[model samples]
Target chain A: MDRYAPPGAGSAAGAERPQAEVRVPEIPGLPAGIPDGGDAPARHEGGEGDAAAPEAELTPPSAGDRPAQGKSPFQALTVIGQIEGHVSLPSQNKTTRYEHVLPQLIAIEQDPEVQGLIVLLNTVGGDVEAGLAIAEMIRSMSKPTVSVVLGGGHSIGVPIAVAVDRSFIVSTATMTIHPIRLSGMVIGIPQTYEYLDKMQDRVVHFVVANSRISQERYRELMFRTGELARDVGTILVGRDAVREGLIHEVGGMAQALASLRAMVRQGGRHQR
Target chain B: MLYSIIPPEVVLRPADGPAAVLWEEVEASGARRLILRRDADGRVVIERIISTEPRDYLDPALQPGQPYHPGRRE
Candidate 1:
């Protein structure tokens, strides 16, 4: 019987998890990892008890009882859907090719508990309209917003980075600036040019309005040649993008957080 | 306390356990840092944190019948 006892039993290892479970402080919303029972351990004060409660409680029934195995509750809006992925657009049976972050974005915006949003991007730039739509939603968010470019934030992502209250691009992250593209089409007249012009104007205007850069510089980057394919766009490195004012800073997580915190602080002040 | 900035490498994975939030590694400023954290607002905070310690474990591979991690100390 003694050999059957777990090696870690009866030690600090035994004391750890129960301690967290018992320690749910009186916060309005439950913490991320703690279990559901109000009368668990509540051992620690404001420690992990507060953070762990929600994850333990909110986990779906289908998830089963491996308390240690639940997905962290979006205690803070954890990424629910894939960025630039799909979520059943009303019109299309197929998922949108680009990042259609609307569902989660809407949830975050509607969530009063969600005081801010952070968008992480590493897209190769798919479906322009879809990307732009996501960007617009992020732009209009009442809560503070920040975007961090991971591997890439190309094509439609140009608008996304600027849409946030602030944006960050890691030194290795690459951002491509290109003109609006189209799929197979039939129009070959002056009307085609008009369509292109309007589309181009939309991208330019959105990027310019959201970012600190002027339209002229944005155009220069977009129209620059020898950077992309026969009709693609220019690619900017982290520092170059910042120098061009398309991005606010040539930073990573720290800068992104600082920006978010500032925005949250600012937003808090306004509410008060 | 709030941080003005957090590096992208300080991200804590679910496997590493939970803290005030969960985090993941991201590229930026030429260092391996955290790219995300759950903030007080219930949002995935992309800011950096001051500590890189493995605070809590959100291990997904724990026993099914178990309702909690073995001795999960906050």
Candidate 2:
């Protein structure tokens, strides 16, 4: 009879029982062996599959392996939608809260690894004080900074666009220069107009100090009539802003990043 | 005072309904606080990581919209 025959088939069944009992543990050991051996091949198949899709493979695994591995020296801060101030705007309105941005700016400034900042402004503009507060913070930072205005940087966005060391406006971008006006409650006293005028002056002064635009010309643009259908303001688009001396150049992301990099290189040399 | 071209009436309009999702701050491992909310599937998802350290922002697990597994260590 074959030694490996089934337990019930052979005359030696009783004698083979001890051998079969010893082999029973090997049945469970097969599954354990698959995990040890199968895991490597499964991983190899996965690695091969990942190699087929290079772009997808690159970001996720690298991001997972080392989150801070490819940290860029330059950080971008996007100021979009409306700038929300002290009072929280209704949830419906898309607003950039100053509280969130202010701390990030501080963190960017304090981080030694961060070499420069790029402010991307695409705002319709909101709260006067909040906008000015953010603009002032950007202006005060010692590190090299650049601003790029894409789409529209209207109203209070003007000061922020100019607050950086250099500014660029995409060819299709537009900026509206307008006098500040109160919307909600007005006391109707002469003091109300005086108070608003003073607020306007703060914006005007900040822009004039930061950019090449003169106060007289800026006021001219602010109070210009017949341009806006209902309001008295001048809309400066692309090269018009540069020609008027409100923006440094008529360009987009490439120019903005290039200028910022050059500025950072120069700043590094000076520090050394 | 607002300086935008958008009208005040449009800017200050009230939302139609109560907010659907509310984010609550939860303390996680490594002294990190995460703003999180449960999704439609009832899975806890991170909304934002509030940490003073800039390096904390780079953590892939702590990214916004990432699933927050309660017992996972940093």
Candidate 3:
């Protein structure tokens, strides 16, 4: 080891992976090399707790693919489709399950070779709990993380997009921020309304805390009635997203990757 | 230090005229396309960003059941 080597360099080997494993992982169409078997060790927290079922029982063979397994110093996570939580969505509907994401995050957190994370989101937004849980996991990661919004990151996707250390969006990508919605049976109860308000509070607080937007201002956008036809909330375009302070910049993938690399370089100095 | 962008490399145009071009290593996030086209004044100026799409990954031996697809190039 060099006399001035970084702090974690020596210890990184403990978590080393095959060199062919590039760390840019975010729910690939199919994840290879995962030890999917009846004897697969007990899945840690966020495993969705259904390891006993046969592989066919899982939603799509790709849902739990381990694309994140690589020896590189960076990892990419894609928060696409609707985020599925306690209940799995239909197989046909695109989804980012919390179960799959949770373990990957843990690996990224523990892996020494992995230094940073990139979150790519193109979700219409799915279950609130699942989305929020993913966002919280990402925001709490010790390694620096950045998010890029391609296409539309609507509804709860708003929280995930803003959760990163830095954010980027293409000139044409847009994000929609509407009040939360519920699809199932509705009892006209006071507690139900209160629960809704609290849920809204969680999303609003997270977005405001991570980004430059103000609390009242965010709510104002959330409740705005005219921007979206037949829906409330404001629609922010590429530059508009930057102006509103939800995302850090109005740039594309290169900018986001550059930012992540820069953060990792800084981390190299500090040796975090 | 790692964040430093890859420098652009100069490539001469394949025409009989006295023209040259500069190209950047573009990424899928779309921030690429900083082509340095020389203007009439013999000075280079930013022309336009050509494309900003994610590149595809293909493998001939990849089987259908395997997790084989052209993923993000960057």
Candidate 4:
């Protein structure tokens, strides 16, 4: 079995194919038609299965304090550790590869069984291009998407937190906004500075467009001085992020799920 | 989000050592901890985490008037 194929790991590429048929495990509370859990549904003729299906029919799939394998209405996608792009990071480092995530996002967008999505993010961030690319794919998805910044969504992670349809930040979560900095030896010429400025503009524009914050305020935060002892930027914690308009609400998993359920119930996201 | 239910009556005192109770979920796939005790009759007692403290990890919104476990839907 693939190391990543542990039960409830969510849809992962099978050991057979790199990105072959993406099979999502049955997160009990999710709606039907959602990716089947590889195993065929148990056919209980006229008793337990029938009773279970009907009871779940009236209500949306939620943890509901039920033992897992509870039906769920959406898939949970987590983005933890550094976002590893084209160049692989060291083996010891905890990384979320864009190559892996890119394929998964495509599969999720294509799968009709999967309804809405809840993206959980906790990253120190990495490659700007790869992170932005994933953010764009999520933003362009047809299904509703909600993001919750569980820990610190810093660096390139800022754009991702705002890329979804709706956003949430827990009371303890923090986000850092700073000017993009390139690593490795640089030419340090006028042209090099110009190139860097252009790239930073791309991130600035994306952040402003997707979130409630304006270009002026965002830039102010990005270039703010005297905040970090070694770096320049502003750190917005929890409600601060919401007040700044970067996140839609100051909430944890409960509020985020409640909002998503309302969106699904409103028919914007058709549930089976 | 896997929880090993240990009843309150069971005397379990953080076996092995103190663990930082953050982001650590006892996955069904064997990421877990066990609490065990040998009784006078040589019977071993096991206490599992039926519910976790700072239950915020389970559902950030699970609050007020609701029991930790769901009502029997059946």
Best candidate, lDDT: 2
True contacts kept of 3: 0.00
C-alpha lDDT of residue A5 in model 1: 11
Cα error of candidate 1 at position A103, Å? 1.9
DockQ, 0 to 1 scale, candidate 1: 0.05
DockQ of the two-chain complex in candidate 3:
0.02
Model 3 quality (TM-score): 0.61
Candidate 1: how close is chain B to the reference, as a TM-score? 0.27
Candidate 2, residues A1-272, lDDT tens digits: the string is 00111222222222323342222111111122221122211100000111111111111112234333533588777788888766555545666667667877887788777888888889999889999999999988988988999999999999999999889999999999988886667567999989989999999999999888999999999999999998899999999999999999998889988988898867741111
Q: What is the lDDT of residue A163 in candidate 2?
A: 93
Give the CA lDDT, 0 to 100, for residue A115 in model 4: 67
**Interface RMSD after interface superposition, each candidate:** 20.4, 23.7, 24.8, 18.2
Q: Model 1, range A1-272, lDDT digits (tens) per residue?
A: 00011112332222343444343344222233333322222111212444542322322233443343222212122111122222221110112222214555665666555566666766555444666777788788777777788777776667877787777889998888877644434667988778777877887899888877889988888888888665545789888888888887888777777777776766531211
Chain A TM-scores in order: 0.63, 0.73, 0.73, 0.72
Docking class of 2: incorrect
- All candidates: CA RMSD (Å): 17.6, 21.4, 20.3, 15.3
Instruction: Tell me what TM-score chain A of model 2 achieves.
Output: 0.73
For each candidate in the order shown, give its overall lDDT on alpha carbons.
0.49, 0.68, 0.56, 0.55
Q: Write the per-residue lDDT of candidate 1 for residues B9-47, one digit (tens) a residue.
A: 121101123234332222211111222333454433333
* Span of 10 residues, lowest total lDDT, candidate 1 chain B: B1-10
Give the best candidate by DockQ: 2
**Candidate order by TM-score, highest to lowest?**
2, 3, 4, 1
DockQ of 4: 0.04
Worst 10 residues of 1 chain A by lDDT: A1-10
